[model samples]
Target chain A: MPTHRIDLSIAGLRLALETEAPPADLGVDERYGAFLADGDGEPDIRVVCRFGEPVAPEGKPDYTAEDIWSMYAGADGSWTAVITYPSPDDAPRPPALLSIDAKWRNAVLTEKRSPGLWQSVITAGAAELLIRTRLVLHDSLVMHGAALQVGDAAVILTGHSGAGKSTQAMLWQEAVGARPLCDDRAAIRADAGRRLVYGTPWAGTAGIAVNACAPLAAIIVLEQHTENELTPLTAAEALPMLLARSFLPYWDAALVGAAMGAALNILQGVPVYRLRCLPEAAAAEMVCARLGLR
Target chain B: MIRKDGFVVRDVGGSAVIVPTGARVLDLNGLVVLNDTGRLVWDALSAERSEDELVQCLTDRYDVSPDQARADVDELLQQFADLGIIQYAGQPI
Candidate 1:
């Protein structure tokens, strides 16, 4: 198997990937093209890809199974590994660990590529973990929401499943000529004096992800309401909402603390709002008006 | 008696945060914050301690009366039990 080493620099962190006998395709999304490093710099973390049969707690693969993914909590100051044990005769996944240090977490994107092993899972897992690790190490974080850049500022809209994040993102695109960075997930970073929101390739159902970024202007937590209203949030009020919207590594206390601080800083620096309104262009206008974007 | 299973205490943003581990992993929504007294109670109960023991510890550490300590300890233990951060031995839920 021919090997290839690719260096990906995202969110100010460098990740070096070494693939052993590459698959038909490594399955890495090119939406990260803008963040590709020259490959000459040192990587913060080195990921070596290996192939093997999924081994359960016992020895061989098992047919009797329960959940698709099972997680075991890590001990003190560690990250929780995504562990899945196949029943008797089904091989269990090699135990993996997710930890506090931004670069220590490893996630497998297991997709059944061949007969026994999950090639896609390993590959895809590497892609996401790489990006996620880079974000964590940089005092930045990712959010489950829609991010848009209108003028000099980036606005992120987030909410629960039915909270109309995508609807609001499209409205921003339609009404304000704002570019939709990513409709599903957005990466936020707070550095020195500025906070930034970046677009990742992982788009939601609407498929509106891009390789773009802007200085963060505001964050709006959405709610479906009959009338339009935007409420500014204080640091204390915004903390939990930001935490809920983040991809938290709860197993690691250090990461959790760092993440909490990052969220608090973002809240203090970036204006956070709770917007309750219908899913319409007017909702977008209302938000823009509040932010003085219009 | 209540024991600290895999939970950890950290000072985060001027607040005491208890991070659970192992099978005790808490969902993001279950994130718990402790007041200064809550932190003291948590520290005293790091090992297995009965309600009376905790009440005494609280009273000795603070200037609270035994009656007030008992009330606070009872409430705190109930909450911890509900959250599964601690367990009472040989007691029905």
Candidate 2:
């Protein structure tokens, strides 16, 4: 029942992980694992990882060590962690730490070796880090691309990197006294059967960030065309397209299906439009007209 | 009138939802309910049967006269037209 703890805060949300004693039958002398639980102490997620002597990919044991981290999401939204050690001789080092700020999110993995060697460890641990981050961000505000406030409502502008997502957000803010939620990454949550999209600290090219949430009014897919036009997309057409642009990586099929189902529920209720136009205020006007805001 | 061709209906979420091969989800409540007669009418409509043809088919299959079958088919067709489930193609069957 020995345990270890790790706490994280992102976009005004706090999450913690509790590690318990590793199982006996896993065949490792050093057995330790952790369960990621919310503040209520109910085990929502679990991570059980063990490390053994560092064995090089080449059939030889190199006291130079490595670690592998695996994660699974429980039915109740908790995560079970499994960390494998290279060998029994390799002592367990401190768990990796990650911090998200206004500029960027950083992950620090500590081992017995120098900082240069941590890169591989960090790469190996990326899956776990991504899962934990996603779990933390779940049920909060999330925008399709980035979100910006227009008048009283928050507008989410989603498109490819060069599709003018940031540019449109800037134009709306400058023309209508609007503010940015986040230019790069938008936080999302579900409330009262509606998905509320919010702005995050991660801003892409616009470098605009403000913490805010709004009931998603519409989702516009951007396309740079000569003529300014807004066309509506049916739920069938929007479902697959939105799934492709979804932020979460496809690690588990069931999780992906659930996420897609949630998205379909949103699309069925919210309006989805295809905005084909040049980057200018005119495009915003077209979008507004489609949303019946104008 | 309910133009039987160029349209299809399927049950979705316990409702008879119409989906044209290249169109959006359209409701066919007036033309078809969940009852046996409504389903039979919908099945006949799928084959592009004319009103007279549908009446004859239904009269032969069910214990109904030609006149009653014709009246039911005509009423259902008008209801389908009002609900946008089908349109008048402006041609003779």
Candidate 3:
């Protein structure tokens, strides 16, 4: 097959993906279709995908996340990540090796040619790792939250797993006719003069992924409670929660600093609230009424 | 004792907060919020200060006596050591 090129734009971050195999044969995940963009202008991030065994970086890795992946520092200020899945089939070799420059601008994704290598790398996680790490450098990071459009602005509900993010989204859709952008992960970016919330392809179990962007209006951290309560949070209270929920590049200090700065900027511009409520439509109604979204 | 690298401390809304970066994040997953006194101690740890020096820093600034300062410093240093935030001499890296 001839070299195939596909461009994708997510949360205003454009990527030029050049693949060695045909686009169809590469088995790229279907969720990325909504993010396909015209191959125009200079891409912010470039990825060259090919099939081969990557040369492992020498010495002990700077950081290792168990057996899933290991990060090695390069002498020239670049970083290489060897991603291996914790499965019997993938145990023999790493599925993908992603190497990005210190600035995370250019990358080469070398994937092992195996039955499920592409899925593990692209769909399971490696792509998210690439986008999130690159995004931090550009004043953006992916958050584990549900984002929806509510009357011209986006409202993001964030919390850890089993914190009822999806439940609240569904209730909002039913009560206030809100449109769900992304149910699991939302790309929060500091664009121009305002903060914007974007729909990412990496949705959670809800599988709600829409290619959309909206100016962020509010961020609600959910907590399970019998009665509905909404309280505004100060910057100090909100920053830690936002940082905990964000997909920050932990392997690099500079990237972590960038991410923390972005989170602080968002907190300053957007109102953050702690929403303690039950899993019912009334909870959504209360929020919309209190926040004037209705 | 020397403060570990890869930890970024910041002031948010008049309170000090510490978050791990780089390899430190592998050990600490979340942010560590500190009170006013905790912030002072953490700042003093930026240099290689001995326990006596840290106690003197507290006693000189605060109204606490030397004996009281020593006990407070010991508690704070124990907490920091438990969290792997500070490395004492002879402690293996």
Candidate 4:
């Protein structure tokens, strides 16, 4: 079988992909465009993708099977993730697995199962899970939100689904000429005295992914409102809201502390705000003006 | 009988939050919040202390009477048990 060497450089971390099939065969292009990189010296993380779907088990569970799922844990210093899928009969089955070294620098994709678009799906799934695990170790985290660069500062808008985070990201582009870093997920890292936000290739339906980054200036929790309003969030209120919006390492018992420690560092370093506004140009203008971005 | 693994208390800024990890991540519904009193109780239970020991800790740490400390400990432990954060010894689990 033919294979392709795909290199992805998001922020400064690298992912070397050795796929049995080209990711292009599964339509992975522009979304991963910003992350395209030359296969440099030894990628930080290696993903060896093999072709195949995971096999489902043949029987139902002894007690209940309504909530079949995956989990990750850190034993001693090693990290492993077990991903179990739901079955129609709700039968229990063996799970696909992934593991990382004690240093959180290396990981192996032990198993993957995709019906057809195996390359793109498996690559994205593995990258998302593994990258998240690694990022938390270094005082950084990823969130289900939109990030935009207004002038020199990185502003993030995030909330639960239906909160118009993407809409506001688009609005900022149209109204203030702010560049969209990512309209789906943004990676925030706390390094030295600076908090930085970077774009990822995994754009939610919005299809906005820029591999750019900027100093994280403020965090905005999106709240739909009739009029534009930007309220402040003290550290007390900001910590929980940020955690609620972040991609936490809930499975890695050891990494939970890591993620929390990073979140606290972020909360202390940057100011968080709650943005309540309409999904319109005026709302974007108002937010920019409030932040002195205009 | 509380799990020696799967759960932990993390400090986000100065606030303490309880998060599940490892196998417990399969049951990721939400996290637990700890106030000062709850933190005291949690610290006491960290080493698998019995109910009587927990009641004593609360009484010694705070000005509450033994009876009140026992009542409060029961309330919090019951919540932890219900949330699968801890379990009673010899219980079916």
Top candidate, metric lDDT? 3
**lDDT per model vs. reference:** 0.66, 0.50, 0.82, 0.72
Q: Write the per-residue lDDT of candidate 4 for residues A7-62, one digit (tens) a residue.
A: 78875678777766666764445347677788756787776655444443333321
Top-down TM-score ranking = 3, 4, 1, 2
The number of clashing residue pairs in each candidate reads 16, 32, 0, 1
Q: lDDT by residue for model 3 over B1-93, one digit each (tens)? A: 978888887678877878897678766767788877788889998889999999999988999999998998899888888888889887775
Per residue, candidate 3 scores C-alpha lDDT tens digits across A162-280 of 88888889889998999999998999888887989999988879888898999998999999998999999999898888888887777777777888888888888999999999999
How should the candidates be ordered by DockQ, best one leading?
3, 4, 1, 2
Q: What are the candidates' individual DockQ scores? A: 0.24, 0.02, 0.71, 0.45
Residue A211 C-alpha lDDT in model 4: 84
lDDT at residue A3 of model 2 (Cα atoms): 60
Over 4 Å off, model 1: A20-24, A29-38, A52-119, B8-19, B26-29, B33-40, B47-73, B89-93
iRMS for model 2?
Answer: 17.6
Q: What DockQ does candidate 3 score?
A: 0.71
Residue A258 of model 1 has an lDDT of 68
Per-residue lDDT of A1-294 in model 2, one digit per residue for the tens?
326444323343433433242223222111111221234542222232223233222222111112354333434433333334333335444443222221112222222332222222222343234433454335332334877666556666677668877677777766555566777766656667776766554456666555557767777788888888888887656655564455432323333434555565667567778888887887776666556552
lDDT by residue (B10-49, candidate 4, tens digit) is: 6544557877765564454667787777777777766768
* Alpha-carbon shift of residue A141 in model 1 (angstroms): 1.4
Please write out the lDDT profile of model 1 over residues B1-93, one tens digit for every residue.
665555555554455666554345632235678877788888877677877888888898899999999999889888877777776777542
